[model samples]
Target chain A: MKLTTLAKTVAAAAIAMPLMTAAASAYELVIPTLDYRTGAYAPNGIPFANGFTDYLTLLNNRDGGINGVMIKHVACETAYNTKQGVECYENTKNTEPSGALVYQPLSTGITYQLIPKSAVDKIPVFSMGYGRTSAANGTVFPWIFNFPATYWDQATVFVQYIGDKEGGMDKLKGKKIALVYHNSAYGKEPIRTLQKMSAKYGFSLLLLPVDHPGQEQKATWLQIRRERPDWTLMWGWGVMNQVAIKEAASIRYPMDHFIGVWWSGSENDVEPAGMAANGYLSGAFHAPGDKFPLHDEIKKYVYDKNQGTGERERIGEVLYNRGLVAAVWTVEAIRKAMEIHGTKEVRGEQVRDGFEALDVSEARLKELGLPGFTYAVKITCANHQGPGKVALQQWNAKAKQWKIVTKFYEPLSDITGPLIAEDSAQYAKENGITPRSCN
Target chain B: MSPDFLFFLEIIVSGLMAGVMYSLVALGFVLIFKASGIFNFAQGVLCLFAALALYDFIAPGGWVDRWFGFTLPVWLGIIMTAGVMVIVAWLIERLVLRYLVNQAPIILFMATIGLAYVLEGMGDILFGSDVKPLDIGLPQGASDYMLDTFGLYVEKLEIVAAFVAAALVAVLAVFFQKTRIGRALRAVADDHQAALSVGISLRTIWVIVWSVAGIVAMVAGIMWGSKSGVQFSLSLIALKALPVLILGGFTSVPGAIIGGLIIGVGEKLAEIYVGPLFGGAIENWFAYMLALAFLLVRPQGLFGEKIIERV
Candidate 1:
């Protein structure tokens, strides 16, 4: 029995040693994407997932796999459920050939639970747009990276946009602003930021939350009508977007004054309302409409090759472009990680470093066929977010397209940073987690 | 408080429209329950499926495009949707619901739940995961002719909805009170065994009732699909009819409409005046609470006849 136990251990070590050696030489990186391909959010989720998958395929086909090391990605559908997302995380953490370098769980609820697990597993989570706003502080969340912007960042940009439109910040004083948000962690992430800004700007912030599977909002909008808010910031998802627009239009609320979060702006949302969505503006991380050079290349190389991820026509829609940009960010992070590690076989720790070390400048973005798109992103020990700058786009009736009007603006970091630290500290203390030492 | 008062009136009007939609859905539920003595939980999914079918028919490069070599117009597509609903109703009667005719209501209800999952899966596979706007050519602009003194701005669609709902209810009422099939349906609803013994074919009654319910579901689907666009989330809206059914009694037609209006208006007022005192979004739980409270008081609902079973 002892001999057999020893032999089994030896065999296991022998099997593992060669694979480890092969991993070092081969330079293979594996990324697990938690996708919601079939659920209430599936309409938006599927296109994004497809764009993400297509970009990796494009890299493999065009660049010969990120400096000759093939990039592998496996998508496990979460349907936007937290339990299923966590299960997918546990199932794909350690697999053959490589360990998971990073995980991007799109759902904020799942991200909250995975933040602690990421520390124990040494795998960083890339919550590009959706997750805990408090995790923007790298000091508290060492293993989590919420790059580009957090929900708070988006909220600040939105409030600033409203202020600018209404003449100045002073004009916002005494003006009522309604926040009609989804009743979930993802939806509520912006409330604290809005509250802070409301206090500073002297705007009366009215809170309205719509329940999940948000189809019925007659009551919520009725409240909006009562408040007679000058502007409304909608943080809705899926069917809620269309419902909100319709209800607002029904009550004769000016659709132009109603702004939505990034998630709320999509072809699906506007197409339902048709001309009713003419003046509605939304906060955007990536430019929408299928006119970008990268999208043109995708159409030529990918869709023309009959290897397209979805309907060829939907290539440049809001959600599709967002997906493609998300993929580009993921790949860029991998490339940075590989560059620092001096090898292609980058592990989870290396990927985390890659995320932290990401320096995608305007030149780099232009080189990648994404010009006038985004700014330089730098993640540090203290700041997980690189920079929060979002452009405002409006739906044009004559052109039948989304036109960007406002240039990028930075979020209220001075207020948001302290709030993030305070919340993160509270979270750590409650969960018995020790704050990571950056020094 | 002028704006607040105006908002209050607006909520009541919109809430009444919402009630119309819920009643249309509840009409289907009551039809099935009266005929088969079984609650069809799958009714909600059926509404979603029908709406999705209508969207696909009108959408560019859809089945109509493949089959007919071109996209059909919206009105024609709607006609095709009606045809599709009929076929689906026939199929349901032939395949699953027919077999469970003599089963206990609990078993039949469970079967409907299973059917709901099946329909939801089929919808996802058939339509692809994308929300499509339901375009029914309904007037979308708000009515400028408002009673300025009362702070009321009624939408043209709301007025159309009220007229259409009233017309449908009146038509159905007259049909049931005057038509031969309507009489047979009522007879069957009262005692299926006795109706069968008296030479009323149970199969015919089941098929007819299901077909009528299918048509009712399509009307509900069209109104809602036009409002929110035809997305999978419409199924959840269909589920709101359950509370309507509880308040109105599963066998009452007028009760369904009146109960839907009361629930809708009540929830809206509650959320506005009372919801903030605790927290916002009280509308989510208010419907269920109202239904539970009503059940405790009336037991058999506003219109349901009391059934005293002998031990």
Candidate 2:
């Protein structure tokens, strides 16, 4: 028995020795990705994970690793669960050598849990487009960033779009709007903004919440039918989005009148409903489809070399492109960190500075091979959310493509500004945080 | 009828239809538990696997197209999937059930939980982890005729699902009551050793029962998948069935159906009438609450056989 045990230990050492050596040999910029590749949400999670990982791989292959320093992407699967996400964060936050530079949780629930920890750990949490909206207040949430737009910004954009559809903002009076949302922190993020808008515009706001996994929404749609709201808005994710679109179609609700948040606007959400998903609108920050020059580069450097993270055909889906955009911002931020610190090796605090000082202009975007893909994002110490501009995209179900129908429009900062202040102030009081002064 | 009464009626109608869908998933559980005396936690994953297989066979540019170079007809794809499920059932009996003959029920249940993860992982590896639209010519969209006549909204897909569930129940009832193998299955469920002494093959009976459960899972998967695309969330519909099982009894087929109806209508009414008071989203917990209350009063359930143990 001792001989057999000794042999087994020897074999295990033989297997792990090479891997340990490879890990120890390189001094790379470590970015921990808390991804969900399996579970009920895997249908949506898989593509985004692929997009994020593939773009990082593109940097490794094409540019020879972010100005000569290799990027060591340590991915931990969370399966879209809050507990698992926190575990992933704890496990990868202090990886060997330089520790984790930044974290993109890709989940709102996980972001909420990590917000307090991030301040202590000083590891910046960049939840692109989906996290605590008040984290936009950079003073209170110095280590947290949700750039391009937050849920509050998207809600205001949706209200403005509805008003525009009705000819003018004054016409919104007496109009009824229903919000079908997932029953979670992520879905509830937009309710306050919509309520303030409804009260200001004289419209009735109806809130309907769907539980997790969200396969059954018959009751919610029945309510929508009875109310006959002038417009319906949804803040849903994963299967909830698909089920809501299908239910809306079943109730014969005009698809054109229904809108979803950016998280809800994806090919996986609409294709399930078939032709009925046509004309369904959703708030978007970036262009969909794989027509950009980055696609060709990724194909040449990643797929041709057989190192692609996902299938070749799934290049430019909405979520995939969103992941690409996320990777783009992350890489640019890393470059900014290197420039600021005057070294290739940087830590979490340095990356936090990089995120705060990010300035991805249109000319910079064109240089990065994603021209006109999205609006410019300029982050500052006082403003981590950037200009909260969102565009509306319509699903052409027959063609299986999303077309950007409106130009990028700004959010209602006049309303979101005060709400952010109030919410952040309350949060600061509860958490005993002293809001930092930028000026 | 008044507009308020009409709205109430509409909710009831919708609830009843939705209940039928839940009953379909619950039926798979009832079958496995009744025959094997083991609560198969993998039943939900089985439905997901079956649906993924059926989609792979029937979908354009799927496994069938990639490998065989031809798109399979819907009927043929279903039959092929049924064959695959039968093989899976046979393998499960041979590998897992055969070794654990006369094991404790909890042990068997734990084995099934392990089996669920294995099958989920295998399904992901076989069929890519992406949402695939499943269209087996099932009628979708709201029923215009019902809306036009009664001012009520009902989905055509739900109506078809109701018919399919009813038909499946009728067929299962006959299969269990009339067939010789059904008699053997009952004997095995009663006493494994006694059935073994009588020359009945326990392995064969177990395989047959699992195959039937697998086929039921396929039907439930198709119905639910047709409504809301074939995806991983399709497995979660089994969660909606737990209340139905608790209310109806795990071993009673008719109880599964009736319990589904009650839970469905009960949750819908609660969500519509009482949800507003709680800030909405009461549908998720309403059924479980009702089931808990029912369990306190009748632990054996509405149709479950009463247990009497001698001290």
Candidate 3:
């Protein structure tokens, strides 16, 4: 019995040893990726996860980690579920020594859940372009960062583009615009902003909500046929995007007049509808396709070395590039963090400081091999969201590529700014958070 | 006709067409349940897998093209996918159903749920988790002829799907009525012990029944994958079949068709006419509510055979 107990003790130690080793590896900067590679959203999630992981792998393979510090990428699958996302955060947050530097869940639902938790844990939740639009108010949401743009910002950009097409903002008057969206928190995000915009611009706003998975949209499309809205904007993800596009095409809804948010603009969404999806416009922050200098570098460092995460051909697809951009921001923030503290080993709290002070200028973007990709971003304590600029991209089915049809333009901040302040103030009051003074 | 009347007619026509698509999936469920008394929960996953296989076989730069150096024509790829589904059916009968033979019906149902997860995983592993556009040369977009002549819009693909579903039902009806194998399957379903006494092989019948069900899944997959790209969510389409089964009865083939039509029209009308009163998106739960009402009135379903169990 004593021998058996000794043997059991030895086995327990063997299992615990590796975990202890992992915890002790504090010298290596740990970045936890909450990824989804299965379930309904897997088609969209896989490419983004691949791009994110591949970029981090590129940093390790090409540059020997971020500033000679070996990066430990710990990936946890959330399956695009909010519950699973919270579970992943709870499980991976405290990895011993120095906890995870940052978390980019790439999901709006997950981002919403983590807003409060990040403040307590001192772990920065970088939602990038998706999350609570009110979280863009940095004073209220100190740990939550949705840089470059928010959903509200994107909504304004889409409306601005529509106005430009009709000659000017004044032309939007009396025009009926329908918002066909997924009936979820993520889908309902742009409604308040669009409503405010409609009230200001005199365009009648039509709300059409399609439930989750969004396969059966026959009823929704038939209504669109009856109503005959002038413009239709979709805020959808995964199969919802594809089905909506197909339904829109079947109704002979002029594809040019229909626009989707960035989440709906992936190749997966348009490819299903074939030539019918041609001329479908969508709001975008970055250029599409794998033609950038960063692509060449990724091919050399990641693909050639067989350390790639996804198919070689699908390197610069929209979602993949979104992931690459996410990884680029993360690494750039870590660099800033290191420079600020003058230390290689930085904790999650220090990373939050890094996020606030981040400034990716145009020259800096050129230096990073991604010139003219996206607008230059500068994150401050007062504004977690950077310049909320967006561009319009059109799908060319024959060429099978997305082309940026317009120059990068700014969102209507006059309306969005006040809306953000009002929404964030309400959120702060409800959550019992004393708004921090950025000054 | 008045414009409003024309629009109402358009809604009904569209609903019937959409109903045909739902019936196509519900048909697969009736086949498995009627033959084996097992609710095949993996039917939707089977559809997803079959579609993924068809895409991999036919698509340029697909698995067949990458590995074998040849791309299959659409028709040939479908035939090959049918063959693959038959093999999967045989494997399921041999490995899963055969072992659980004579077990409780719930046991068989649970096995299918397991089969679903396994098949979903296998599909992702084999085909990769990328959504692929499937084009089997079926007509898509608005039917210009109908739109111009009737002043009503109808999708060409949905029309094609309606025809395909009708043809499939006719073929299935004939197979069940005329074939000797069909008689054996019915006999096995009625009394397993009695069928065994009559020299019928339960295993063989199960394999054949599953194979037929699988082919039906392939058809449903093709139609749906053509509408929306074949992806992981294709499996979730099974949820749409539940209300159909409840209203139509789980064991009746014709019942699936009628149930699909009622649910389709009822939900569409509710969503369009009544949904706005309650803020829209009521179609998602409208069918389930109708199914619940049906259960209180007629539990055995509209076409289901009422079993008289003697005490």
Candidate 4:
């Protein structure tokens, strides 16, 4: 019995040895991803997690990590619950040598919760396209970074596309536009901006709030059928997207008139409705498909070596591409941090500074093997809303692909800028935060 | 008739049809409660599990072909799922229900909640968390002919679901009236002591009732799963079904069906016609508010029996 116990103790020690040594190493950047691989959102969550993880794997294997120091990626499953997300942040924020780098809370609700906490902890947050739109005002929210584009930016893009389709921006008058939004912080984020645009453009804005985990929208569709809104925009997620598309198709609503946010444009959302969802349009930040040069490297080093994160074929779906873009930005920030700090290794605080000073131009993107994927973003000391540009993707049933039909549109800064300043100021006042001056 | 009036009538028609879907789920709750006096909170998860099981057996890149060596047709897949549910019912009766016999109703209800978590976890584990297309060749889309002839917009899937729910309720009613085991179940539900006095085994009745509930759940899962994919949100239909159960009264089978329709129509009507006055999406709370208002007048529910205690 004593010999058997001794053997078990030795085996346990051996199992824990690599983890202990990895934590103590200064030659690695720790990125603990807060992932939701289970629960209601997992259908959408799995592909995103796979894309995010696989990109880092590609860099680690092909390029010998970021500047020779490897990445230590840890994933904790939050199941899309806000409480669990906070717990995951608490559990994995501290790396032994480098401390924590940055956090990307995939859920907007989770991002809101982590905002105050992240500030207190002095860790930068990256809410990539789907968090507090007012966090675009980096002067008020220095710690919160909603770079690439915010929901308000995307909402403005949708209105722009509508305006373009209607002949011109001046023709938006007397148009009946409706907003069918999820009833949460994530869904409600774009309401104020849309309301402002409605007043400016002389369009009627009908706001419909679908409760969380929205499945039953029969009555909502009936009202739409009766009211006959000329155009509708949906801020939906998971099963909500599929149901809305099908219900809209059932009522014979023109698919071209109904648009969903970027989060609502995944394959899982459209394929279930089959051919009926043919012309449905959605907001997109990054181009979808695996024809980029980075794909070749990823295929050779990660997937070929059997180190891929998810199903091999699903690497180029909408959400997966978004996840890959998020990681690309994350790595670029890390590289910028290394340069700014003039060190081979950097800490989270230095990384935050690097993020503020970072710039990913078209030339940098081409060098990184992602050409024409998305617009270049440059973060400034006072401006964190990097390249607030968005494009529209249309689902083609016959081709079975998401084809981008519009070039990226810049948000109407004349409207969205003041709204961001106002909301972020309110948040700062309520939370006792002193707004900082970049000068 | 005016187009406005026709539109109102069309919304009402769809509301009633959607209510039938809710009633189909409430039908499962009524069966177990009538026979065994347990709420069976796991009814929603059971619905998802059944659909997941059926879809996995037939869907390409699903649980069956990935884990097992064989594939089956859609009909055989459904039969295989039925067999799985029977085994699930057997395991529940033997392990959980059998031990908790004669416990307080609240305790039994809590145990079912525990069962819900277990089933949800097992479903996620056995079938991966990704949503699978659950097309068993069911007809989808609305009939253009119906709309053209009568200016009515009726969904073909909803109409099919309505007929299936009616057939289920009718068959269950006949079985309860004509079968000896059904009579034994009624006796047990009436009084456990009296059931024991008459040589009816309470354990056997409980097992039979649970198995019937499982089958009802499977049918409900198929319809809802067919509407959406076989995803985690399929389990949330339980919340929608609860208002139906409360309105229908827990013990009456036909009452459950009618109650489901009433709540469904009430909520839909409120959302479309009345929702404009109040911003919209009132379907979420309208049913609960309606049930709450109805309960104030009829505490025993629309068809539940009056309770009298002698001091």
The positional error of residue A434 in candidate 2, measured at the CA in angstroms, is 0.8
Q: Taking the tens digit of each residue's C-alpha lDDT, what string does model 3 give over B196-297? A: 999999999999999999999999999999889889999999999989998999999999999999888888999999999988999969999999999999
| Candidate 1 vs candidate 3, TM-score winner | 3
Q: What 10-residue stretch in candidate 3 chain B is worst by lDDT?
A: B300-309
If ranked by lDDT, best first, what sequence of candidates would result?
3, 2, 4, 1
Candidate 2 per-residue C-alpha lDDT over A180-268 given as tens digits, one digit per residue, 9 for 90 to 100:
99999999999999999999999999999999989998889889988999999999998999999999998899999999999899999
lDDT of 1 by residue, B211-247 (tens): 8787788888888777777777777776689888889
After TM-score superposition, the amount by which residue B104's alpha carbon in candidate 1 deviates from its true location, in angstroms, is: 2.5
Residue-by-residue lDDT tens digits, candidate 3, A1-439: 7999999999999999999998666488889999999999998998899889988898889898999887889999999999999999999999755689999988888998998899999999999888898888999999989989988999998898889889999999999999999899999999999999999999999999999989989999999999999999999999999999999999889999999999999999999999999999998999888988999999999999988989899999999999999999999999999999999889999999999999999999899999989989999998998998888899999999999998888888997899999999999999898999999
lDDT of each: 0.82, 0.92, 0.92, 0.88
Model 1: per-residue Cα lDDT at residue A318: 82
Query: Which is the winner by DockQ between candidate 3 and candidate 4?
Result: 3
Off by over 4 Å in 3: A1-26
TM-score of each: 0.92, 0.96, 0.96, 0.94
Fnat of each prediction? 0.79, 0.81, 0.88, 0.62
Candidate 3, pairs of clashing residues = none
TM-score of chain A of each: 0.92, 0.94, 0.94, 0.94
Can you rank all candidates by TM-score, best first?
2, 3, 4, 1
Candidate 3: residue B135 lDDT (0-100): 88
